[model samples]
Target: MSKRVHIPEYEQESELMAGEELVGGPAFWFLHLCWWQEDLRALVERFGADPADVDALSDRLTDDDAPWPVFRVPFGGGHTAVVALRNFPDDSGIDYFVHHPEWGRLGHLGQMDGHDTGPGLSWKELTAIAADVPDGAEGLTDPAERFLTLLPMLGDIDTPHDAAAVVARALTQCGIPPEHAPHIAGKILDNSFWELPSWVVRDGSPVPVCGASASPRAIPLAQGITAGQARDLAEALSGERKA
Candidate 1:
């Protein structure tokens, strides 16, 4: 279960190295949305993998303790895709590589270096997003819970509709019926919600400090505000009015 059965050769390869060019595609995005083993198995099968290999790859990926997990997915006619997970201190992301019989490993996929705009949504922004939820929207009551539910989709959200889709997905994940989830999502976005105060980083952590007179309360960095947002919050806390 720890090693991939589809491509056992990869088990001996060094995990430290990856392709130079990061890549992504429909499969990559689909993989991002998959959190459960069954869904992953389905994805592997769709890529023309053997039934046994499909199960093996899915199990290996879901294993939390698997060291430097990597897998080769068959894409038919001798072409394969190599998927690896890159871990960081604060986050982890997947990278993809194409492998062919004639040519070895190709470009890397899904590299975010120099492309990421840092953290996506701030706590205040998330609060604003959650505030849009209607008074009685089922399973969306707690602001903190709503924020955590929406965290995975934050980077992809650009519009209110995108936010609604994320909410709908979250609702579905919470066991709400698919048909009802969208209806509830629409209702959640129909009204505006109140905003929370911005936060400043004090002692390498986020502290909720709105204005000059407000007392700062230190909170974990997991609160989700970016460094830039923290600086602005600091200025506001210091009573330095922006010109």
Candidate 2:
């Protein structure tokens, strides 16, 4: 028997408005996954391209340098829906716009306030792109890996259960067997396997400036060291312990 998930009435309404049958949970999750991967890739490429000037690299890593078009969905009539993260100066969220072949760009469909809100684009205006996402693409096949990859992007979620629900839903959407979502979620929570960066608003814009964020499990894996060796890695990274 399939598990009965209880979606809030507001979310149900949003789903209906967005065409639940088309850009449902799977498509939504896939869009976010694409954005997350692209954002990381852009940052790494920038640093790799100019590794000599650390200060210049830091200055260039602002929202202005972020790669756009988190993902695109092509529709009939030569129209395409482009999804991307809202500029930090505007607000921290996701938004989308449609593009016509001859007419140029259309206006935004809607904006979602992080993962707490509804889909930014509607199915009436956008086609399902999740179905076309190749399996194992970007090396994101394992449920645990997917959850960890998405953890940093989930800073808006406060409640533990809510975060777990998001992970479970995304896992199921991304082709993880439905029956295994609960177990995977449990393991993730038990291990506490991810770290989140701290953000601050600078000159009226949110910036991820703190680089000392570390998780108990992540430190060891990051340094390719055993748990015993990483016992003080978090403290050292945070400058809480002397070398």
Candidate 3:
């Protein structure tokens, strides 16, 4: 299922200085996968190129030393729509656009705010180019839709090693000793969201409990404890007091 998201309103007239750079807009790996899918390939082919030849595309975009515009749109389920734009060398007053599920897009030079509708061109044109790219790719209607469309790609990753450290700290908050908490990963529901196998560790094994946010205010994974999860954690806390 696609996650629902909202775009934060920002000023439309912001601009970037010359020679500024925006890197990794189009989630590099996903761009590679688009090469194998026919529908997705058609979208890129419209620009007279093969998705398999990313180097060629990259080279062309950087030939003129122009700045790239990058954006990250957040969705509710730990997913963000990313895009960047490159300048159109052949065409006058046009730009090349790219997208990644989380990383971002490579879009036209000098169009940072995504609100310019210059002479019959809107920031959404490239999104419309891949509008029918399939596999929920058509969901790139707005910043939010684009984010939800890419949310599913994050569902199959292993827990990042760094989280173990954070989870260790989180355990300490519940009065559990971090040294005894030898940890493992949780299911990859969304790579962008953070959760552990459970904060409850018993007998040198993790007792899978759910619903606690390590940092309720951080990027990639910031959430709150659910009432039920909080209750379970409270029980664990009480157990700590008893012991």
lDDT of each: 0.37, 0.33, 0.29
Candidate 2 lDDT over residue span 128-218, tens digit each = 2222223333222343433333333232112344656655665665555566555554444443312333332233211112222321111
- Model 1, 232: alpha-carbon shift in Å? 53
Q: List TM-score per model, in order.
A: 0.27, 0.29, 0.22
Candidate number of the best TM-score: 2
Who is ahead in lDDT, 2 or 3?
2
Task: Please give the lDDT score at residue 201 for candidate 2.
Answer: 24
Clash list (residue pairs), candidate 2: none
**Which one is best on lDDT?**
1
In model 2, how large is the Cα lDDT of residue 150?
30
Worst 10 residues of 1 by lDDT: 209-218
* RMSD, candidate 2, Å: 21.1
CA deviation > 4 Å runs, candidate 3:
1-56, 60-64, 71-80, 84-139, 142-153, 157-243
**Candidate 1 lDDT, tens digit per residue, 1-243?**
233223333333334332212112223222333332232334433333355544554454444444545433332223333455544434455544333444333422222222322222333444454443333322234443344333422221224446677666655554445665565455444421212234444466432322212111223321344555444433332333254
TM-score-best of 2 and 3: 2
